[model samples]
Target chain A: MKSNLELLTIETIAEGFRNEDFKPSEVMEAFLENIKVKSELNAYIDTYEDDAVSKAAEFDKLFKEGREDLPILSGIPISLKDIFLVKDKICTCGSKMLSNYVSNYDSTVKKRLDDQGVIILGKTNMDEFAMGSSTETSYFGPTLNPWDHERVPGGSSGGSAASVAGRLAVASIGTDTGGSIRQPASFCGIVGLKPTYGRVSRYGMVAFSSSLDQAGPLTHNVRDSAILLDTLSGFDNRDTTSLKLAPTKCYEALKKNDFSPSEFKIGIPYDLLREGLDSEIDQSFNLLVAQLEKMGFKIIDVSLPSSKYAVAIYYIIAPSEASSNLSRYDGIRYGFNEESTPETLEEFYVKNRSAGFGEEVKRRIMLGTYALSSGYYDAYYLKAIKVKRMMQKDFNEAFKKVDCILTPTSPELPFKLGEKKDNPLSMYLSDILTIPANLAELPSISIPFSISSSNLPIGLQLTSNKLCEDTLLKVSSILEREVGFKSKT
Target chain B: MVEKKEVLKISKLSRLLIEENKIDSFLKNFSEIIEYINLLDQADTTEIGKDEEIVEYSFRDDSEIEKLEVEDVVKNSAKVENNFFAVTKVIDEE
Candidate 1:
């Protein structure tokens, strides 16, 4: 019964809450129990067992009192990536630099989840400052994949993905800068969505690559992604980048099932998959497409030509922005070694950062500083921006011909731990497929649909034009129904 | 290829200290990434506009709202005196 409760989806749990099958406190106990048993998976950096239990008990009391005005997500259990500030709780960003730093206020998403009375299980682990492709760089240590202890869960949201995949948390919220969310979700065989660039507010979330970073849900299924996105979406005066688009109705569309697959033309960039993709994933993708074709949908062969340069463009632009955004850890304000007395301010900053940051974080900071340096700025940073515009134009042209594009989320299956750690270049290629959507500021989702022969999970992705998450979710739900994938991993 | 001195210079500009022993491996990794990003030069960007993409946000009304306590703001500082952050003295006194 405890294992079964851990596997319940957001929708089912919400229904069970209304039906009085079990109280919110019971759900909390079951999940905390699973987390305790699977403690070695390292999915969580900190588990708020006492706090979560108390909150769940309070909600259960409210439920028993017959409160009718409670929110639909009031009793849902979820985990948050450590990047968001939770007001007095430590917001580490998986780096030693701010490992013990406490946030004074809540991030917008954190406030939203709390306002809805959702029980936050704990803060999950991640790459240091969300810099690396593997969770190995985290100061707290790597989060092992629950499916196979020797393999990675893909990162920097590896712990977020693992928490949901391991059933440690019913769902999780993770930030994506160049496929940080989807890549891990794919590797872990779960649903991960990176909402349109400005769809969600980033007021209190730590900045990685400001232009590319956007948070979304990693869930067990498509409907759950929609449910979480709806709660997290809206315009915020605090976040100037927040879009003024209409609030998402993804969950509503999912329940209504109002979309027909026949009305949409799905595009597959066969040329992009001609190389670099694993044979099994390539075959699985083709089979899924054929299945969609059999369901009365028209398939088109479309290519975003400039997408070939996604990695190169992303590397230049992300690091350039990151170098500037991460300039705040000067140790005078707040950070590791804030208490240290150094000979000079410069020495203080250099010393704290050198000791605090891992190799990957320093590597990025150096690369970014070099790219944005006076002489080389125009050659690298400016050129990458113009090329990013070209990539956007390519997507614009493709979207005119196709309703949405479909592709494999990752080029390969879950890799063994340390398989690509030594090779930074190859690690960057892990997000090659998921990076284009981020570059073009488009909305996309990765859906886990099949398990490979070796018992690893594989995911297929869908990308829709910006502010079209309704259609994206609708079509994905249809695909989800047709594929009938559940109990992933 | 990035040389040893260049890596040190950039690290200085970024305010990061790089010990001498790790400089070799750091330079190796940094140069490879720099080389990888050079592939951007292959794109024909002559007609492309280099103008920065501007995202226009409406100016919000300036209204007083609840604010953080001075103590909350400076609580993380190593030295706090009279509700302010105290850092290392930068100017040399005569």
Candidate 2:
């Protein structure tokens, strides 16, 4: 088995497959070998060794027959965050609740990826229900950051990000509710994109906060992300919210769009830069801005005054939505249930839920329930909705003036495992800058910036208007090139 | 300040049982989180008057589609009987 296939990106792997440099099964084995060697990273929940290998063989045979219908991602090995259901496979959303549960049908994401002829390695671990900032809350365990074993890979999409960064898989897909994909992508020294809401269908992707949840790409570079997003995005009747727009435009634009850096005006919301940002991150971000300016890109200061309340708005709205969505996990229908007898329906539900969920998930559920409860609903849930409108208004105003907005993907570098485990507020606050974009339903991507003095990677974030992933990927790829930052090899 | 009893109440509503030992810490964390999010109170939404809720529904013809088999629907249940979910008794035996 060749060793370099695991490190080859989706784009490079596609080129290799086109050139018949190596068989797809060889690529699958290389990734499988890497997964076995890096098992301690705990990136993968399970590896479909036989299934993935067989699928790669089928693709290889198709290649031999001179098939003209092969997509750009044909034979590329990738991983999915466990939340996206793969039919006939277990879809454990990083929670004990669905540990034994098998998916009955393919999530739209899985169906789309399957159509692309991509070889799926397996499902990756995540924060339980994609709830935590780090993968620590996963029932399987925290996915250790490959850059530094002691540190965390920022999560609920930590495993997806880590798989790409650690080269355990060629590229992966992760969901970003509130920085789940981007933050992990930043921490793992890779590119992660959270596309505009409704850009991709959510059917089969488990709901956390229904409105805030959208799936996108986690990859080694911006082009790969565009390619994956192109494959994953489209309208589906199964997902009513999925946009009825032309699909597969992102990768084409990435290949053909020629808007020079000088034509782009990137905004920096200096006001939203909280006081406690790590000084090193501040220096690196400033350097990045200077580099963009040097490249003839116009950098402007835009104000998003309401973004300061983003954390507060996200906590209330996400949890309130979560409380309702999660109610489907009643013990009678599906998910984990007690083996022992409970006399009443209420007792059965409480017994299963209390035992099924991890700490952070329960906390969010309770917080959501408290907010949406009778008297408090107006003060908490309604109030947050009003504030969310303000946040969205701010983004609307900003986007009118600038093509895109720039911010630090994370306030700090990847922290040590167990660092913020007990501090839920701090963990929630970690998402401050990222939440505003989610609130506005805009497209955002995190690109690797530079390594800190401690050798951990940091990422710079770019946000574009809703449904503007084309420009988002354009700006990101430009920055990805300008910086020329390489991940730890 | 959020009280312990309020936390318990929220847990009851959420269908989650907080253990006796974990309630103290759970309550502590819950209170702190609530306090932190209270920052939203500072944002003046006075001008943001009652935004009338508007929901736009996209209409499509209601046509028959393939549906999950009964066994497929109930396969993930902890207990399935008669091709349906089996649950604890909902009625009392007087």
Off by over 4 Å in 1: A1-3, A338-340
Per-prediction count of colliding residue pairs? 0, 0
Q: List the candidates' TM-scores in order.
A: 0.98, 0.98
lDDT score of model 2? 0.89
DockQ of 1: 0.77
Candidate 1 accuracy as TM-score: 0.98
DockQ of each: 0.77, 0.77
The candidates score, on chain A by TM-score, as follows 0.98, 0.98
**Shift of residue A258 alpha carbon in model 1, Å:** 2.6
Q: Write the per-residue lDDT of candidate 1 for residues A240-353, one digit (tens) a residue.
A: 889976668888878987668789999998767889999999888889999999997889999777888999999988888889988998776788884567898888888888
Give the per-residue lDDT of model 2 (tens digit) for A1-489: 255877788888887777878889888888888899999999999889999989988988988887777898888889999999998899989999999888989998988888888888999999999998889999998999999999999998999999999998888989999999999999999999999988888989989998899999999888889888888887787777778877867777888857789989999999998576889999988988998999999999999999999888899999999999999888777788878798788988898998998889999999999999999989998899888888888888998889999999999889999999888898888887788888888999999989999998989999999888888888888889888487776
lDDT of each: 0.89, 0.89
lDDT of 2 at A105: 91
